[model samples]
Target: MNMRRNDVNDLQVKVIPSTINPSSAELKCQSSCRLPDRSSFIWYKNGQKIQDETSSTYEGNFSPADSSSCALKGFEHHPAPSVCVHGQSCNRVIYTDRSICASRGSSVDISCTYSSDESITSSFWFSPDRSHQWQNPSQPEDLSKDSQYAGRVQLLETEKGRSTLRISDLRESDSAQYHFTFKTQSFEWRSSLPGTTLTVTALQVQVIPITVHQSHMEAELKCLSSCSPAGRISYVWFKNGQKMMKEETSLYSGQFNPGDNISCALKGHEDYRSPSVYAPKLPSVSVSPSAEIIEGSSVNLTCSSDANPAANYTWYKENEDSPKASGQIFTITDVRPEHSGNYYCEAQNKIGSHNSTLHLIVVTDPGTAITIAAGVTAAVLLLIIILSVFLWMRKKRASNQSSEAEERPDNRERTQPEQDNLHYASVQFSNNQADPLYSNIRSDQLHRHMEEQEVIEYAAVNFNRAGTAPRTRGQETGEDPSALYSTVNKTL
Candidate 1:
């Protein structure tokens, strides 16, 4: 009896955000009439039954574009209207979604609140796009009455001041800057202030290539609209045309098989999905030089794969426990006999992984090596002999130059004309001990020698003391003024 009554009515769902401005939520579905203990409930988003959501309670981050409702499991036919996901009811001309992206050929709702101090005489939405086309450009016209928007525009005043502008059969030409204007008796809210923008676009799935240090590499895909605003948008992803697990807001990030196809739709417009982007093709490995690798030469191994998201590359040698290298090009600077091996490169992305192998053989010839070594050794020996000989000759030349320099003075001495025979003369100093040379002061022998050598030179003396009349030097000496000293008679 309770089950029947509950079925006649409808299930009530409460949607609450975790914060005032929310990106996450908590939801509960309840039935007024008591049903069986085993009674189950299902979740619905935007009037569509959410796959695999059969719990009475829901906890997650949901798209702001979505509205949510709930239903009893067996009576899915009579669920109540979905309440908007947002709990925001802010005053003023605050738009619930400042930027809205909708699929072409679909419908979208842009909501805002316009309140005023004076009584609102008139309230409506206008597009700058249609205003430019009007005969009078200064005065904006209502979008619903415009011929271009005929039969496709709706204005619903949800409450006293809240309003929603719903546009159906969205076309790319319908993309425009939308504004809400409200007029009071004294003033009009001008369109100069920026308003909400609506973008009508077809969804596109794009692969965003990334280089992650992790070994278990996963490619990241992003859902994009052409010329879209730069921010995170909620999305629904599909793999092989099947809805991905629980329909996450973020696209799938994991390994995928070769035949698998990936596609995505904007979260609110899940019915209009983009074309599928396929996974990686078989990887191809190629070696540089296209000839046998030579000893002591560089070798390059390149790997490539065709995929929606470009593939990351890792290189491995056949017997190595760890990856030998990473990147599309793996280079061995100096290939040697020990480097000969079977190597392979694996190309991977979120979609899948594929690899191709290459064989390398480092060629070495023992006879050629020995011959080259012998030639190098012989050349080095010859160079050493030549250097030694050159150094020895240089040393001999230096010795000769030194000997010539030393003997040059002696040779000049032998070549010089003879000087006059030098006289043998000696000046004797007395042992008076107290300035004996000045006391006795006689050099007859030196005088005689000077006479014979005809080389006489003399020094002068000053006998005048301070404060005395300057004496003529010869006056005290009683000798020629040219004479340095005559005799010093001490107390005689």
Candidate 2:
């Protein structure tokens, strides 16, 4: 056993070993100060602290060419000086965390506490998995000096025998097992393999639908990363880019209204949140061929919108009460004038809905327009010609009827002279809007035809026997008082 009374601040400590040789042994401690519990006692070696090793006794071995010391927790500055005890080499390390998980692009702290039984000459951190490819290299290169870690690695010595390797802007390639190395005046510290393992991953948000309804949605969101989470990891959530309060967990279950955007991040790395998921945005519509569409030509309409959940599209015409088609694209087989109008598209999702700008569809008239117009003109001309022919035929028939009446034989016998003096005249009138002859007919035209069914009874002419009267056809035939018959009683 080795003991020393290197009193510092009148606080002395002694280490008692079960064996006096240079090998593993049981040791105990007694302090000159008031003895509290053993857990409050602090152990030291080679004028440096063995962090977290707080016991009145160190129940282990020592290096064959090294030394150790002890003190109370609060009296560490007054530690009892160390004594050389030959047992074995002094090269041991204890990490604050065996494994750590961090998000990519974020910083991380990989810390540890180490002890050596000899005076430390140099200390640095390294990664064995990324070391040089040479066979059995002496030791791995310092991480801070490596080109891959330049300007982003920070080597910190928080205190004697304690170190922290902070890496900024971490990447997946930086993931590996890290170790701490040190050199003494006589020998280099042998590293304990697998010092601290770092796992770098990108944050992602995954949604699983729990319940779906019309007004609202219930879903469970999980913040996921490739790195295996250790222990109780805390998580943070955001809604519409604003921080939201919830219990610390990787999974979140809640009701979301329409148009809500969600994201997540590790509690300590909230700056590196996952991408946001949301409903549809304002939609846009486009027409194929991009020029004027003609009748009978095929045209396609496409609707597009940005959304987390793929949006469904619907096409509708203005002033119409129904939707024309559904899907991202709407096709018209043969475009016609009926298909020409103002149209718009709707992009919808479970969360919300959006509409596109109105577009006017104009189906141009084809080359057949001139032919159709010519056909209509021909039909009108034929109708006019037929009306003119019908009027001519009616006029000829009326003239023939008058001639027959003149040729009809009278039933009563007439004196030969009276028959020669009798002369008769007949006329006919027609009702037609377009006939100029019908418009000029006089009202006293011997019981004119007033309707489709009318009878002209007779026409009688009276002859006066006065001397001063104008001469009639009968007077020219002979000097006698005769009857010029024109007495007609026409009944309708």
Candidate 3:
């Protein structure tokens, strides 16, 4: 007698004889047996049942040549059993060991086994706590979550008789243990022990500096990734797939921040990017003493800017073949019509560049130009008018002095007597032309005129003594008897 252990509602016993002796097999009675609380028995031999069997232990016999044996089957079906085995109809008792799992940027496979050879029609996989139902056997082709598996999930079909589930796109979030279930004929699935904890990791390569100014001389870019405690992180920068030697970070001293952030600075690589660096705009330019140019004339031009890197100047001639000249002065030795056009200059540095334009035109020598001619004509006209006014003023002053002399009573009295005496002297001198006293005749008229007035008389005496007595007199004063006697007495 063999006792079968069961956890479900059923208790069973099987009797397999150690040796079969004859056509009829009989058994001696066992006095005591441990049976179920509520049990029934059935005895069968060669697909046939015995006619009567009531006692737990029986001694019965049979004839030979029948090829028969007696079998006793006791089943306690009041409560359901917990363990399902072959030829046993009870709830299944599934068991599996705990598991540990891990993966990288890809998928992971978790496996479980059963205790019995039960036929399974389907399978399912879920996360810890069974909150997330990952997959069902009927629909296993969906891979939207394939990214979570890192693109490398595969189910194992042939294994140690276990239902294994493979998950792809393993991320950090997929680090928990998973549960699995296998469906049997009754559409019932028993869960396996929670599988191993899957540790999903990845090697990341990210560009640190995301933005930069155009035509930046030098730009520093960093690439970093999350690494295992045992793994090392490496970085290299690529431009259009061509690696930059200066952009390498092998000698960098700093590591990624706790949250995986890093940065670097680039310098002195002016041509690293395209176009040009961003800088302040160029300053407006102007020229002083603006002139319409002529041959052999000089002009000055100035350049300025609002830039950080100080602006350099270069002159550009538009529609002309003149060689470029720097600085402010452009001396045109012999300017021609061809030298006339639009001219500009470029002021620039690493910061920025700007352009200013000026128009040049050809004309005659400014010294001898028509405009100068007009200015000279006006100046000459003004000088002539000033000279004419000056001469007119001088003549008017002479005329005014003559009129003033005629209008002054004191000086005019002396002038009228002098005039009358001059008339009388002229008559006397004309009458006595043949005599030596012709000069004395005019002086006698002045003496006769002076004798008529005391002031003139004194003046005559003084003038005769000084030998300057005017010949305008009618007669000599000394020839007068009265005057001669007075002079002699005075001399006495």
Give per-model TM-scores.
0.35, 0.40, 0.23
Residue 4 shift from truth in candidate 3, angstroms: 37
Per-prediction backbone clash count: 2, 12, 31
Deviation (Å) of 184 in candidate 2: 12
Clashing pairs in 1: 219-350, 256-351
Between candidates 1 and 3, the lDDT winner: 1
Off by over 4 Å in 3: 1-104, 128-152, 201-492
For all candidates in order, the CA lDDT equals 0.68, 0.67, 0.44
Please tell me which predicted candidate would have the highest TM-score against the true structure: 2
lDDT of 1 by residue, 1-32 (tens): 44673442545668767874477888888766
Q: What value does the lDDT take at residue 372 in candidate 2?
A: 57
Better of 1 and 2 by TM-score: 2
Reference-based lDDT, residue 240, model 3: 32
- Model 1 CA lDDT for position 85: 64
* lDDT by residue (tens digit), candidate 3, 400-442: 9989887898787878776565232211123324332312233
Ranking by TM-score: 2, 1, 3
lDDT of each residue in 331-390, candidate 2, tens digit only: 987787788778889887655677885564544665455555667789999999999999
- Indicate the worst ten consecutive residues by lDDT in candidate 2: 429-438
